[model samples]
Every structure is written in structure tokens, then in C-alpha cells.
Target: MDSMMMGAMSKNMESMPDMGMMDMSVMQACMDACAACEQACTVCSTQMMDCSPACMNCADMCNTMMRSMMRMQGMTPASMMAMLNACIAMCQVCMDECMRHADDSDVCRMCAQACQACMDACMAMKDMMMASA
Candidate 1:
């Protein structure tokens, strides 16, 4: 799904001036990270732990972020940056919450790892955008 979406997005990039300078691989990585994080959060939320609320919220945010990336025609560089920041923030909160119970719960540990990966991917996207700007 991600590769297909990225291929379509890459085709559309010809009409987006600044987008031509963007790294499609980085964008693909970010989208993949968002998807993985969403899944991890959904699974973690089912654990009924103290991090459940954060996990749920992070999952929703990640899904929204991933969808926004897919619909680049509706996004500006500013909006993309804002969405990335929001996603990173949500991931941070979720990661922190999950980490609190990581010592006792494997699910929490995995969720925290996913959140960290999502945050890193988001930051990479942000950095790439900034560099291109």
C-alpha cells in the first residue's frame, strides 16, 4: 500500500515545484513509520494500561498524518511542517507514557519503540523540508 501510494505521489511531484527537491524515500519512510506506529499504538491501547489514552490519541494522530502525506495535493509546505510537528509531539507523549511501564510490559516496550521510530522519521521529514527550503 505504501509503495503504491509513494509511486503515485512521485508521479504527481512533477507539478509541485519544491517537491521535486524533496526525497521521496524519506517521505516513504515517514509514512511507513506512521503506519507502524498507529498499529503499535492500537495494540498497546488494548492492554488497559495507564498509557491507553495516550496510545489511542497517538494512533489517531499517526493515521491522520499518514493520510495527509498521501494527499499532498491538499498540503502546503507550511501545513506539512505543522502536521509533522504535531505527529512528533503526539509520538513523544505516547512514547513517554509507554516507557513508564516498559520494564513490566513487553507491549509497552514495543509501543514505545514504535513511537520513537515514528518521532525520528517525522524529524527526518522535517529536516529534509527545512534543508530543501
Candidate 2:
């Protein structure tokens, strides 16, 4: 998203007391990573490999996580933490599954990379939230 959109989103999220200290840059990075992971997983799922199921599931999870972050009006810190945990867990599974075929499949390798990036971004968001809490 553009800076203006992020600023607007941050303004909207400021209504939540627990989100007052949120770092917009970290949030934007997390959202961007989620979107990239979702797209990578969706493409990887079409490879019809052993990791297909995990890829599909991860794609859905990432999409949901990204959407939830974008619509933060009703989200509490606890709920946000839970969502990040779930996204991290899903990314881990997908990354592991994709890595299994990474030696032979470029798509799987790319998907694994995307999953790793998403996990890292989510972790950063979690750590930032904890520190601000």
C-alpha cells in the first residue's frame, strides 16, 4: 500500500487503545509479506505435488491474516496476537512442506522463501507489539 493509505489505515486503527503504539512500517511489511506468501502458495499449489494441500491451506491463512490486519477496527491485542501466531504456524508448515521439494522444483523453493519471509515479518510484528505492550 501507498504511504497515504497506510497513514489512513493507521489513523483508523488508532481508535483501538492497544493499537496506539503500533509501528505502521512493521505493519505494512507484515501485510506485504502476507500478500506475497499468499500468491506464492497459490501458485505452488498448482504444482500438484505432495505440498499442494499445505500450500493451499497456507494461502488461505495468509489471505485471512492480511485481510484481518487491513480491517483492524474490532481487533484487540489478544486477537491480533492469536492471528499472527496462527499465520506463523501455517507458514512454518507450508515452508517445511515446500522445502521438501525445493531441490527439484523452483516454484516450491520460491514458495518456501515467501513463507519464510512471511513468518519473519509476522514475528517482527509480534515482537513489536509485545515491546509496546
Candidate 3:
């Protein structure tokens, strides 16, 4: 999924000024992580368990973050960084909530893992952007 999307994104990247310094691979990884996190959170939310609210919130944030990255035409670096921070924060909250029941629930455990991965990917994207800047 990411590979195909990345291919399409690459063409658009050429039109964005200073985007040559951005690493498409990192963006791809971030998008993939967001997609995975969204799926995990959605499934976890359906359990109608204690962490459902946080999972649902994280899912929404992940989807927004992924879409923002996809539509970067008017996005500034500062705005992107802010969005990444927000996504990371949401992921952290969801992970903390999910981890509380990880010992008893496989879905919670998987959701926690997905949140961690999404956080890591967002951080990586931020780091790459800073380095490029």
C-alpha cells in the first residue's frame, strides 16, 4: 500500500520547493505506521473495553496525520512538526491506556505495539525534517 502511494507521491514531490531534501522513504514509513496504528486502534475500539475512547481518538489522529502528510501542498515545516507532535502525543496516550490491559488482552497488546510503532515513525519523520532543515 505504501509503495504504491509513495510512487504517486514522488511525482508530486518534484513540484514542491525544497522537497528534494525530504526523504520519501521516511515519509512512506510514517504513512505505513499511521495506517497500521489506525487499523489496530479501530479494532481495539470495537472491543468496547476500557481503552476504547483512547483507541478511537488515536485512530482519528493517525488518520488525520496520514492525510496531512499526503496533502502537503500548503503545509509548512513548522505545521508538519506540530502535527507530528500531536500524533505522537495521541499515540502515547493510547499506548498507555492499551498497555494497562495488555496482560489480559491480545488486541490491547497489539494496539499498544502499533501505537509505539506510530510514535517511533513520527519521531523519525520529525528528526529527518530537522536534519534536512
Q: What is the TM-score of each candidate against the true structure?
A: 0.95, 0.97, 0.95
Best by TM-score: 2
Q: What is the C-alpha lDDT of each candidate?
A: 0.93, 0.95, 0.94
Q: Which ten contiguous residues of candidate 3 have the minimum total lDDT? A: 13-22
Name the Cα RMSD for model 3: 1.2
Q: Per-residue lDDT for 5-118 in model 1, tens only?
A: 678888897688855488989989998999999999999999999999999999999999999988888889999999999999999999999999999999999999999999
Deviation (Å) of 59 in candidate 3: 0.3
* lDDT (Cα) of model 3: 0.94
Which prediction has more favorable lDDT, 1 or 2? 2
Prediction 2 global C-alpha lDDT: 0.95
List model 3 lDDT by residue over 1-133, tens digit each.
Answer: 4577679987888888754378888998999899999999999999999999999999999999999989989688889999999999999999999999999999999999999999999999999999988
Error of 2 at 96 (Å): 0.4
User: What are the root-mean-square deviations of the candidates from the true structure over C-alphas?
Assistant: 1.2, 0.9, 1.2
Model 2, 18-102: lDDT tens digits are: 6759998999999999999999999999999999999999999999999999988868889999999999999999999999999
The deviation in Å at residue 105 for candidate 2 is 0.5
* Winner on TM-score (2 vs 3): 2
The TM-score of candidate 3 is: 0.95
